[model samples]
Target: MLRPYREVLARPGALAFSSAGVLARLPMSMVGIAIVLAVPEVYGSYGLAGQITAVYVIVHSIAAPLLAHLVDRHGQARVMMPALRVAGLGIVGIILAIATAAHPGWVFAGAVVAGASIGSVGALVRARWSYILRDPAAIHTAYSLESALDEFVFIVGPVVATVLATSVAPTAGLWLPAAAVLLGGWMLLSQRATEPPVVRREAGASGGSSLRSGGMVVLTLVFAAVGSIFGATDVSTVAFADELGSKKAAGTVLAVFALGSMLSGLGYGLRHWQSPLWRRFAIGVVALACGVSLFFVVSSLPVLAAVMFVTGFTIAPTIVNGNGLVTSFVRPDQLTTGLAWVGTALGVGVSIGSAAAGAAVDQQGAHGGFLVVAASAAVAVVATFVALPTLRAGHAPAGRGAGPADYATVVPNSDPSA
Candidate 1:
């Protein structure tokens, strides 16, 4: 089952890059939470505290593609080194500011610096693999494995962050991701001897500018829908736990929910599809939608766990397919930037969804939040269904539609002649 990953990691620099990904992400998840815990010590209002946390994610999401473009244009090591130190310094500044109760503005500013400096390591790491794994099958396998590893990061990063916040100072754990980015970037640079050289693939290609490609537009829509649902579902699940009068159940429910996703992602990595890309993707959509719908009906924690477990089955493969489409639809050189665009889209969507879910929980209740989740899934289903014909053809119709163009024209690799 693990042979494909084992085979891929055996290649020069692959393992090193993977380790860098872990190091970079370890602190990434906790960055927002750290802001939440620390800002409150400075300011009592939760809203102000939440804003400080939100700024980091919002800024990071907006800045990721720009940073990725820098790396795409320059070398990854060159772009990442300075950014890493900035992030580390930002972490220390935040710790000092909050410890001294100097100013809330300083805390917010430090968070932004940390965020902006953290460049999208996931995107950077994936781009590295894209340059190395040229074959379609190998690329798919690499992406699936990388995503599974990412899930592990999300799972572990949060738990560790929570523990650190509880046991150590919240600011202390902040150093991990910041330092990891630098450490990992340096480790990755050492592998430059075996690395794929940088390219200007757009310098003389014959395709029109990538801005109007159909695949990219579809990807944005798909991710927006999926990510929003996740954000809403997470907050809603906690709300439901509260509704049941078991506040502690929130953590238990979430763990099961994540466990479901982790196991399903594992299955997705190991299983080979016998169908076409669009067909598999469509099936994944159905599974995802069904899972979303189930949340509203299941009230008991155990049943919710069962529902969540079932719901988990489709997420990893759907995302894997969505990412796999990137290579097929865009030029080879644009892969990292393309995926960065998609990941950023999902991040934005999740932010919106989580916000909406939080509001729904506060106003309408868990049922209402769950309903919003179902509705979001329905939107994604409709969006993907409408795009299926064009998707199945493996390319857009006569003229490029929105998806391809959306990703293609963006920074990092955008050019008219390409």
Candidate 2:
């Protein structure tokens, strides 16, 4: 299991980029909660904090693909470095506004600005791996590692943010993430050795709308539904802990969730499999729905934590396969943008889910949010099958139906010229 990852990281520049990527991506997990926690301290309302966080995510969903497109047309360091700086400044502005007791409106505006500028570093990290690792199996392991890193970041980020906010100051939460982004962004950009070369879109290679190509539209919708599970679960967990008179337990519970995901992701990468990508994706979706349903009945904290750990088992596999599907559907030059669309869809879903689940929590308590989780998973399951005809066309050439030796050369509809 570790052999593949070991070999891949042994490649020159891989460790540097991977380490930097982990640091940069850590902010993704921190910022939402940091804002949610910090804003309430100033405004005295979780409602305002939630709205600000929603604006941040919604704007990010809209802007990430555009920034990623620029990265594809230009270069990762060129585009991403400036984006990181702008994002840092926006966070600083928000901190300053909150310190000065500026209106919530200013905070919302700052969030939007930050959201627009914080590029999808996770997607770019995967794109870099796609460029550097040509072997299909190696790519699989690399993606799994990346997914595990995501789980790790989520585990670390919330705990760190919560600690800083509770033990230090509310401002510390946002300030620390800003500093993290700057440091990580600089480190990532400085390691120019592993960056993917810019692939300019040729004349007539505008390739129409990417959303129309190879069922990307359907896949993105699936991602949106899946993302809802994440958003609902996070908020519900915190609410659950609060109800139990142990608010800090929320972080530990959530960490269990991430632990399950991270371990499963690592286990998933340890071997290659012959199962069809879509089939595995379908199973993962079903498992997630069933797993999350367990939360609906749990009344005790121990039971909830255990259920959450088990429930997290399917997330990474689902995400890994979903990303694989994206790679098969777009041109190499469009990879970053294509991944960004999936991330955007997820972000949009997170905003929607968090808002809806928060309302549900207010009305019916934490467990009520489980309804949203199960429902969203069901929606994703439905979308997967509904999009099957289109996906079958797109996945056939490189997926289960293809010869093993063909895996390296198979492009599906990914190459516009082909």
Candidate 3:
């Protein structure tokens, strides 16, 4: 389990930056939990809060790529600091708006600004990994590590978010995430080791430029489905929990879902065997779809948790394979934009899923939300299966750039010794 990402595990700086990204992302859960708990608790209306949440998500969907492009054009450090400051101010503004019981319009506006400015450390850190890991084989391993990181963030972030929102004054808890994002992102900026975008120069040159390539399209779709699964399910679970008058279980349920993914990822990493990449990814999609549909049947928290756990199993491997395919076609230059595509897909999907599900559940109820989530997963499963035959199977190792750790040793080549 630890072996694939063993190298990242060894690097304090790499791990630190990754952790910083996690800390930066931690507020996502807090935002969701806070909106769900606080707005409803204060206003006595989940429906209104859900609508506001939808607007917040839409802002994130629109803004992620713009930020990523800036990161690519400027330095990640250069783009991140201002974003962090903006996001921080937005958080404070949100608290003040909510504290004063400001009009719903004010709350929605604040949320839009906050979500839009929420620095995309995920893109930056993954780009950084592309450089730090260096070799293709290591890159796959690094991708696996990143997949695990997402699962980890999903598991822990929500739990902490919920605890703070429910236990601490909602405003106090807000500061934790705001302060954390500033500290962590700034710390990452200070690190000279973080990777920047690769600039395309002639055929084999490097500098800094935003470029996109072949596998990126597929990656975006894959992440869109993955992100939708989480977003849809979070809302579905919330609707399901609400059916029984229990909202506290929302975070616990998500945490269990992450736990399942974590275990699967560990097992996936340890296995020397990986399926044909597309097939592996398709299988995960199908599994996720089936699992999402099963959420409709969950009537209680325990059953919901179990369903989430079971469904979570396929999350990491799908990401590992999807992103591994991305690295396969990405050029040395334009690496950040290539990666940004994946992040963009994720951002868009999450926003759509959350917003759609929130609205769906508000109007139609929990079962309807599950159906939507399942349908999204099914789209990936069916599309991937259709494309499966024409595409390659399994994650064959390939070197991304000039490096010792690249897939050179594993993938077939004319000079096996090269």
Candidate 4:
């Protein structure tokens, strides 16, 4: 298991950029929860806090692809550095507004700024991996490592944010993410050697978006459904714990869920399978759907936690393959934009799923929320099968045309022709 990770990280500049990326992307998991924790103390309204957080999420989802496009047009450092500064300022503005007890409008404005500018460091990091690594197996391993890192971030970020907010100060929750983004962003942007080269468009050629590709469209929609499962499960788990008189254990249960994904992702990356990417993705989706269906039958907190841990296994492999599919469907020139779309889809789906599950829980309890989770998984399964032909076509002849041999061969570092 560790051997594959070692092989990938041994690449020049890989460890530095990937480590920096983990730091920078920490804010992705932290910001929403931080806002939720910080806002209510000053404003005395959970409703207001949720609304502000929603603004941040929605704006970030809309802005990530645009920023990625700019990165493709210019370069990572040139675009992301300014964006990081703006995001930092936005966080500062929010903290100040909260401290001063300023009007709600200022808080909303700050969220908009922060969201629009935070960008997608994860997408940027993965783009770098795609640029530097030539072996398909190495690329697969690298993506898996990143996926595990993401789960690790989600596991640790919230606990730290929560502790700081409750024990230290309400505004303190926001400070960590702000500092993290700045420090991490600086570390990543300074590593010029690993940055993907900008591929300029040809004379008179159209500036086509990644979404125009059928495979990309299918992926975005399917990932949206996957995100919905995540959102619904989170809300329902909290509600379920509350129902069982063990509300404090909710965090533990959720952490177990993340742990399952982290472990599976690490293991999944170790393989050099001969299976087609589309087939693997389809199987992963179906497994996730089956895992989610078990939630409806869970009756106790202990059982629910166990179920969540088992279900978590399906999350990372599905996501890893979904991202891998982007490399297959999208041109190398538009790779970052295509990857950002997956993140955007997940963000949008999370928002929608959480809202829908919240409503369901209100009407019928945790079981109702689980119903939503099941429904979302079912949708993902349907979408995957329905678009099987497109996925199969897109994944056939990109870089992995020769199956396991592609994993053995290493192409040169120069960019492939657009």
- Taking all chains together, each candidate's TM-score versus the true structure is 0.88, 0.92, 0.83, 0.94
Query: How does residue 84 of candidate 3 score in lDDT?
Result: 80
Q: What is the per-residue lDDT of model 1 for residues 1-418, given as tens digits with 9 covering 90 to 100?
A: 6776777788787888778677776666667766676666566767887787788779878887777666655656666778777877777777788778877898888879877877777777766676666555565677777777677777776667667766887565565665666676667655664343445543344444333578677877888898899888878988898888986677666666666666666666665555676677778887899888989988687888778877876777788777776656666445556777788888888888889888887888999899889988998899899888767776522211233233333323223221
lDDT (CA) per prediction: 0.72, 0.81, 0.68, 0.88
**Model 3 clash pairs?**
135-406, 136-406, 137-407, 199-207, 211-334, 275-394, 276-393, 276-394, 277-393, 277-394
Model 1 misplacement above 4 A: 202-210, 395-418
Per-residue lDDT over 49-95 for candidate 3, one digit per residue giving the tens place of the 0 to 100 score: 77777776677766777776665545666667888878877777777
In model 3, the worst 10-residue window by lDDT is: 407-416
- Poorly placed runs, candidate 3 (over 4 Å): 1-4, 41-45, 103-105, 197-214, 245-247, 271-276, 297-301, 355-365, 389-418
Query: Compared with the true structure, what per-residue lDDT tens digits does model 2 show for residues 1-418?
Result: 3898899899899989999989888779988889878888888998788778878888888899999888776778778898999999888888887878798788988898899999898898888888788777788788888999999999999889888887888877888778878999999877776777666444544455568685688889988988887888877888888998998788898899889999988888888867777777778888988898788788888988999899788989888888877777877777889889998898888777777788889998887787777777788788888988887678744532222133223222234332
- Candidate 1 or 3, higher TM-score? 1
TM-score for candidate 3: 0.83
Error of 4 at 205 (Å): 5.5
**How many residue pairs clash in model 4?**
0
**For model 4, how does the per-residue alpha-carbon lDDT over 275-315 read when each residue is reduced to its tens digit?**
88899999999999999889989988888889889988988
Q: Where is the poorest 10-residue window by lDDT in model 2?
A: 399-408
Better of 3 and 4 by TM-score: 4
